[model samples]
Target: SEMMIMANWLMARFLSERNLPAIFRSQPDPKERLYNEDQGTLFQNWMQRRLLSRFVLSSRSERHSGLGLNAYLTATSPIRKYFDLVTQRQIRSAFDLDTPYTDREIERSLHSLEQPMFSVSRLQYQRKRYWLLKYLEERIGKKEEALVLNRRRNGYQVLLTEYLTECMLPVSSGVSMRSEDMIQVTIQHVNARKDTLSVYMA
Candidate 1:
């Protein structure tokens, strides 16, 4: 993972320095820090993940806060990702080994990809959630351990330790809970297609 990050970082710098047009991945700083190491290593990591910002792809290079880099792009995983292949081609073009793409061309390509990429991402997320919910259905009514991640207006956002899935657990008026609290919960209902999972304090 480290090597991949380094390679992508270097490739991004190389393309930017040469004024090449390529898809650069950029991410802003996280919203806020919710936990410190003193709280608990696991809890801190989870909170950090929760606070992370979403990454975006563009023709212009920009800082990637998640990777703590001034600029970054993904040139690896060509077979697994279309943007990687496009970035690799840009690098090859830099070395006079392939055709070069103009900034306008890259921008148009990104625009064309937006819908397809969003659709694929949404499908993958829904499919994974469906399977996970199906797995949980078998354990409905069973007690499971959960970690409170955040307190919402009407409920608490919790991580189901056994499955690593997050769900909202509504509490009655006057009920109180704190972040990072570990509590037992009973899975009351689950619907994979509807993407609903109901749980309550056990």
Candidate 2:
């Protein structure tokens, strides 16, 4: 949390000092503005699209997995996390007694550790995502060419002018278009509630 706060501050300072074109400006209180509603929606759409592409279409081998009991035991931390330390002590006790914990006990210990780890990981992920979106929001209202990557039931996902950033052009958002059509998009969304950009074929 501290790191994320510091990063936000640093970005604000950088943007201000360099006269950067960004969707937001620094406030003394550390609050940020998206510069526009469309930009926010575009950013959100981009993040969701990128996440879907990477996770849903990526190779199975690229996914994370635990090997087995050893993997589960090692995944829990012995320091810093309370549940991890407790689990470690329990496992150590069983080992010292020449009777290891049952599979169910080990599984339960691992399950108990998952919630905290996932919570921490998700917080970090969201913080990073916000920063990245802020960076792009700075470029709002600019016309850019993009490629249509996929057509959803409601809209199509497009790769933005920048590399790797994908945003959805939802039909409800007023871009009634088809897939594989190159288009010029004016950033129409960027805010705390949404991160998206609007587009139409040039």
Candidate 3:
């Protein structure tokens, strides 16, 4: 992954310097920082993931803050992604082996891909989450150890240690819990189709 990022970053810069039109991936800076160092506890990393900004596609070059790159595109996985293939073609154009896509052509391609990409990503996440929830449903009534990730206004966000699945645990007004604290919780309900899960202190 590190090498792919480096290759993508260098290729993006190469295309940008030559005024080539390639589908560039850009990400804004995270809304906030949870930690500064590379090494952080699982809870800290989870918090930081929540703060990350979504990456966007563009015809022109822009900063990709998530990867700490001035410009970046995924040119290493041509078989797996459409934009990656487009980028690979752009790189070939730099070597006089292929015709480059015009800026308008890249923009049109991105516009056409927006919805299909979103649907595919959403379906992938929903399917994975559904199976995880189904697994929890079978183990309903069992006590599980969970780590408190954060305390919300109405409840606490906790992750089941065994499955690494997160669910909300509502507490009474007077109950106290802190982030990173471990607590026993009982799975009370789960409905994968509706994407619902409920838990309570055990």
lDDT of 2: 0.48
Model 1 TM-score, 2 decimals: 0.83
lDDT of 1 by residue, 1-202 (tens): 9999999999999999998989998999889876553574556777788789988988989899877898899888999999999999999999999999999999998999988989999999888889999998899999999999899988999999878889999999888888889999999999887889999999
Candidate number achieving the greatest TM-score relative to the actual structure: 3
Question: What are the TM-scores, per candidate, against the unseen true structure?
Answer: 0.83, 0.42, 0.84
Candidate 3 lDDT by residue in tens digits, 33-54: 8787677887888778888999
Candidate 3: misplaced stretches above 4 Å? Answer: 152-154, 161-164
Worst lDDT run of 10 residues, candidate 1, spans: 34-43
Give the candidate order by descending lDDT: 3, 1, 2
Each candidate: what lDDT?
0.90, 0.48, 0.90
Q: Give one digit per residue, the lDDT tens place, for model 2 in 167-190.
A: 776656655655456677766666
Off by over 4 Å in 2: 1-102, 161-163, 170-184, 193-202
User: Model 1 misses residue 134 by how many Å?
Assistant: 1.9
